[model samples]
Target: MQEQEVQRGVLALLQRIAPELEPAQLDGRVALREQVDLDSMDFLRFLISIHEQYAIDIPEADYEKLVSLDDIVAYLRARLPTS
Candidate 1:
């Protein structure tokens, strides 16, 4: 998948996880926790959901890199096997 497609999928996944968040709310520069108001546990849940959905094991150390919507997409794009 292309990077743009991964970003779109990440955005959709986030919306599915957090219904309160709209696509407009998540930009590349915005911090996921600060901008989205997700606490640590909430973020963990979000990560778990992403992992479950994508069948990708996102390590905790890698979590630091996932600071925003763009980051999440990039990380997933890099880690997920391309078809």
Candidate 2:
């Protein structure tokens, strides 16, 4: 997928997990947990949502590295199959 498409998917999943976020607020730098108040359960849910969307598995231990939009995009770009 293109970067914007993946980003949109990620942002949409985040909206499902944390409805307080506005699309405009997704600046790709906001710390996710801090901005969304996501706890462990929410974190897991977010991971599951991402996996379901992208068909990629994110191990539990690696979730901490996904603190920001750039972080997630970089990680997912690495993980995803090259076109």
Candidate 3:
């Protein structure tokens, strides 16, 4: 997917995960747990959402690489199979 599409998907999933969240509340450079106020389980669910959406395998060790919206977008963009 394109960068814009990836962005949209991330934001959409964020909304699904936290309906009370506002898009402006997320800082792309900040940790997602900080921005979204997610506990360990919540964060795991968020990661699972991304993995399910993109059909990607995300090992536990690599979770840190997806700490922010920008990070998630960049990671998926680089790893997603080309159509």
Highest TM-score against the true fold, candidate? 3
- Per-residue C-alpha lDDT of model 1 across residues 1-83, encoded as one tens digit per residue: 78888877777767766788877655687788787877787788888888887899987788889897878887888878887
TM-score attained by model 3: 0.89
lDDT of each: 0.79, 0.83, 0.85
Least well predicted 10-residue stretch by lDDT in candidate 2: 25-34
If scored against the real structure, what TM-score would every candidate get? 0.83, 0.85, 0.89
lDDT of 2 by residue, 7-40 (tens): 8888889889888888786567878777677898
Candidate 3: Cα lDDT at 22: 88
Ranking by TM-score: 3, 2, 1
Question: Residue 54: error of model 1 in Å?
Answer: 1.1
lDDT of 3 at 34: 84
lDDT of residue 49 for candidate 1: 80
Deviation (Å) of 36 in candidate 2: 1.4
Residue 34 alpha-carbon offset, candidate 2, angstroms? 1.1
By descending lDDT, how would the candidates be arranged?
A: 3, 2, 1
Residue 32, candidate 2: how far off, in angstroms? 0.8
| Model 1, C-alpha of 20: deviation from truth (Å) | 1.7
